[model samples]
Target: MAMSNAGNDYPLSEVPPEARKGLASLAMVLLGFTFFTATMFAGGKLGVAFGFADLLLVIALGNLLLGLYAAALGHIACRSGLNSVLMGRFAFGERGSKLCDLILGFTQIGWYAWGTATAAVVLGKYFGLEQGAVLALMAVFGLGFCATAYIGYRGLEILSWIAVPAMALLLILSMSVTTAKAGGLAGLLAIQPSSSLDLSTAITLVFGTFVSGATQATNWTRFARSTRVAVLASLIGFFIGNGLMVLIGAYGAIVYQQPDVVEVLMLQGFATAALAMLLLNIWSTQDNTIYNFAVAGCNLVRTDRRKTVTLAGALIGTALAVLGMYDLLVPYLVLLGTVIPPIGGVIVADFWLRHRGRYPLLAEARLPHYNWPGLAAYGLGTIAAFGSPWVAPLVGIGVAALAYGVFNGLTRGRTTAPASL
Candidate 1:
């Protein structure tokens, strides 16, 4: 179908006739995986704070399951050209969709800021620069990200080509060095985690990590030419890319005595690989996030989608580069981490229960401008994600699903039409 600008606009239908390519398509699948690997490593560091071997196991298992679910998210994005955030519109109403966009967009900003800051610090420490100098360095990188984002998704796709391979090599190199340092795989296996794992916590971590990876699937899937390609690419990302990154990251804790030390090993393998990987990884991830924001704008306004997305990226990227943004971004990151899973739950439930092989959401003109049920369910999900102590983040998602199901069932008769791409 030709893209119609007369109604609600979205990129899945707006992408020019020739912008799609196999490499660019595959990069979309890897985008979320990159962020996920970073989170798993960070989560492992946090797991260390808990101090129980069993807990780590539980978390690892939870993250694994979540990863599987995330891998499947590509089906939605690729099948529908709608970016993930905009996909919510059919379920949440156009206005309600804005909430999803705002939250996800902010989370992306945090990722960009945290990543740029991290790279700056890594570089600064390596060069023996002072704290003040590190902040300055991050500012420079942040500007570069903004500049690239402003050029649009095409530019981002090119950046991803460079980043994905670099990150893969860094991951491989880290695993090799860590194994060698620990006296090989056998020796690394012998070293045990000091943390304990309960089934619930483990499940939460596994799912948490999975949702984390999935958040970007829709953005990339929007470019996929076919559902089969999208699903296959996503499987590779979930099973191959993420599997290796986590296996290496988690094992790094045992072998290197510090997971973050993976970078140290990278530095040793070839000078600057660590820094290069860090920069490229963040660049790859940030561009996808920026693309989603652009799509969100297309949904909200009739103006040029690319320009709006670029403006959003520039503003968010610059804010993230400013001093002390990382410290503030951490809590929000955790909140975003929690907020995402419920969305996956709703997406899965909506696809399975409400649509049942028919995408009611693909026809924008037929959709109600305001879907209170969707809005209510979305709010309930966020609230649910907020309640748990150990995994309060998931509360919103779990609760939202149940609430939506119950509400939709009781009503039993609203023929909500899907948004058309």
Candidate 2:
């Protein structure tokens, strides 16, 4: 079948040139990826537990590592014009790739639920609303996002342009007000933390902030016109956008002893701003979560049901959030932080080592049902992540990359394409 963006969301084919985007649009979309409420939540934890100086060091270092991980997969996405799930068909094999689809898809659904429920909870607190009212708000947020995702990438881009700047402004406002009232930057630095978060655990939380979403960056980066654009988009998103979120949480925590962003704004006499920020901030992540779910579901089902799958995911997530699934769902997001990056590890190794910057057209490529070596490495990586107490994501990536490289090296790096092609 002839392929185009159409209703397909490019699940099974390269994104056509006409649909390819530039650095700015890709950056905008990637920036939205970091504007998630979870980053703020993680930041709040860091702020309360660690001194400002220590928190800065960990957040910067952690995000840089995440940036590199996202950039590597992003480079592959742009070069191949394939999202993570389709790329998995090559690295993990055709049928085997569905595992990636399921993992990626399931995680995104969990994220959507968390974002929706969190927003509902925050809004409920602000409005003194409760129970059924909060559930209705979840449905409202979920369905609203479902419409955005139903329109696909363009919708995400448009929404980000509005939400990112608004959220950032509110974060700055809360930080400024809190800092002034509590003393200042020097005072914040001078004040000792209430306690200490272990360096390893703090770093883990840092990684866990966006590690799951980082794996699926190709969903946005595949629109990049070049590999450099893809990498730049990711670095800007993870390093700057994510770091700012941490700063907001850290500042508010240190100064006001409040880590919840909405609470911080409300306490600062910005009730209107707090509500606006909460709605938009959580909406930014919420839309992308459902969008990512739709893309993965399309790949999983072997159809171009992006919009249908998107709406279905929103409904599922909204239902879960109303049922109080987010309290339980958050841990899965944290678990995925460590487990999901191994997929990127295998992908980076496969793209850089095996294909050497290029791959045959996905549709015409003769691929196996499962690339056993890749699957084996992924399993080892997951186990290693669980087995290790420190630097779990990094350890998983290293183990997976080495195991993948070794297996392929032993096999002479076979591919479906003819050698001379």
Candidate 3:
């Protein structure tokens, strides 16, 4: 299909022309906070229960590594304006790129399904509905998501702007209240259970919770005006915003010592706050899933791109929702979480190690069409990640990076390099 984009690039184009700086930054920041509530409280709560110091250490380290890779991939998306699946062509060749898209599309479908289910759960609880009713609400949410998917990135950006701040404010307010209830920041810190979390589990959860967010990051970064904004946005999003969210979880843990404090806190004074937080969290994350799925769907069809996206969203959403598998979202997220780090590892290796200082594959329109070596490397990375549950997702990521770097050295001799020196 012939594609055009006035002066700017088309939605799934390979190169995006310059855009408004503030808009780009705003979009990214908003995107960053989509998982703020979930990641912060959920991951942090797990950490505090396991061990506070250990959890903080785990979170810090995971964020640092995850941030580096996310920022790099995000920079590429921002500067190139290519939907991430299209960008994979630069790394995976044509057929390999297709496979990458399918993998990404499938994973994104899972994410969207999970997000829909989460939205349903939140809405159900807020409205005092039953599970069956929640499923109906989930369907409605899924429909809204599909509608937004059709409207494209502009709609997503607007949704991001509205939902991001709403979520953030709720997070801040909840954390503040939890802290005050606990006595203060110091008091919150002092409260610890008899059996604390181990250091490794805490760190793994930190990496695990945000792994999905990190993987889907390019969906928003593609709109960035510059690499600086991309990196800064990620830094703020993952580091600062992530820190605040985790602290909220920690604060919740400290204030409520009971077994089901997560539930209790929501029902107590934090009910309204939790509902807002839940809705915002679900919407924010859902937007990204919808956006990426749209991109992947467009790439898959390459004809009637808009219709392709709508169809893909509906089919995937319906299948998942019908399965009534909301409870499965977290486990699936954990699985994807482990799978993604390795992809990030390969991206780092490809962009940084082999390419030297330029993105030759991106610059060139064509490459050796079937890049089997890249596939092998990615496969090996996947294998490694799957086997390394103890380390969570890092195992696969590490393996993928090494395999890609070594394979690139032996086969292609590093034609492409990082855009930044």
Candidate 4:
């Protein structure tokens, strides 16, 4: 099938060298993606459960692990000039790649639905709007949020440049107020936890909160001009940016017993700032989420109509949002943590171990229909993760990679290697 690149953001092909981006642009875009409200909420949960010192440690360790995972994938993406979905063709094979498309595409749309619902519900409460008005707002915001995604990479970059700084300022302002109210670092140390949670669970919450996003971050990292840029940008975004979000949430929770930054701002008499923060926070991530959906959708159907798929996805997300995606956040997040990380594990193992860190161009590579080793490895990994009592995402990645290595070794010399077109 001949693939089209018009307004499609190279969904089926490697990004050309001339189109690669510098570190600053890529980092800013990723930072914008990571400055999410849900992450803050997760931090808020940890904040209430652990003391300030312990909370910081958990945040550090969790975000550090998340950052390392993203950096590894970013390295692969930078080298290949293809995102996870495109890379799936090599690991999962030609027809088997659709499994990745479905999994990734479904998760992105789920996120889109949750974000749309969150925007509508939060805005509605703040404005004293009726339930009908809230649903209408969901429809409006759901479609509106896809505007940047519809325009593709340049659109995401422009929006990020504007939103990242504004969000940083708002977060700093809220944290400063929270500190003053809590009587500074000394007073924060004096506070006692109202809840009990183990260190392992706290770390899992932090890591799982954004593992899906980290996995999909290759969508932007593939644009990096060099591997160093990719790795650094991944750390900046997943570590620094996500860490800040978690810190702010924890701070607010400890000070005001609220995990949401926007609500914390409202409590601090910054109603206007809260509104601005809400819009910027949700819009930035929403666009990126839908953009991810479009990329996966394009690959799923083997089509180049990204804009069309984006619109269709927006509608589907809107319908889901209206149907109550907001209330489903906890279960949805749990599902994401279990299922998403193993896909990345398989991709990494396939790229580095099977292909020896190099992949033939997608257009010129003739691959098999089903790579059973990859699929079976993914299943084994997912089962291990779901059954493990420890951190599920980490288990999923490790088991998946190890299983892939074993399977690939056993299958070597029995199956034919992929051919060049």
| Candidate that scores best on lDDT | 4
Off by over 4 Å in 1: 1-24, 27-37, 46-64, 130-133, 210-213, 266-269, 297-303, 360-364, 389-399, 415-421
| Candidate 4 residue-wise lDDT, 282-380, digit = tens | 999999999999899989998888889999999999999999865775476558668989999999999888887888767777688888899899999
By summed lDDT, which 10 consecutive residues of candidate 3 come out lowest? 1-10
In the range 264-285, model 1's lDDT, one tens digit per residue, is 4654565566666666666666
Order by TM-score, highest first: 4, 2, 3, 1
What TM-score would every model get versus the actual structure?
Answer: 0.82, 0.95, 0.85, 0.96
Give residue 378's error in model 1 in angstroms.
2.5
Q: Under the 3 Å rule for N, CA and C atoms, how many clashes does model 2 have?
A: 0
Off by over 4 Å in 3: 1-11, 20-33, 50-55, 130-132, 257-265, 303-311, 328-330, 360-364, 413-421
Clashing residue pairs, candidate 2? Answer: none
Per-candidate Cα lDDT values, in order, are 0.60, 0.83, 0.63, 0.88
Q: Tell me each candidate's RMSD, in Å, in order.
A: 4.2, 1.9, 3.6, 2.1
Which has the better TM-score: candidate 1, or candidate 3?
3
Tens-place lDDT per residue, model 2, 179-291, is 78867878777888787789888888787678888889899899888889999998999888887887777777777777677777778788888788778887777788888
Residues 1-421, candidate 3: write the lDDT tens digits. 4443422125445444444344455444445444544564555456347445555666667677667657777776666665466666656766676776676777777777877776677667667898788767877878776665566556556666777676667666655666677677566457665556565566676666776566667766766677787777776677655655665565555556432323545746677666666666666667667666666766676633554566567667756875876457657656766666666666656655655434543445545566665677778988876766466677777788788878877875433444531
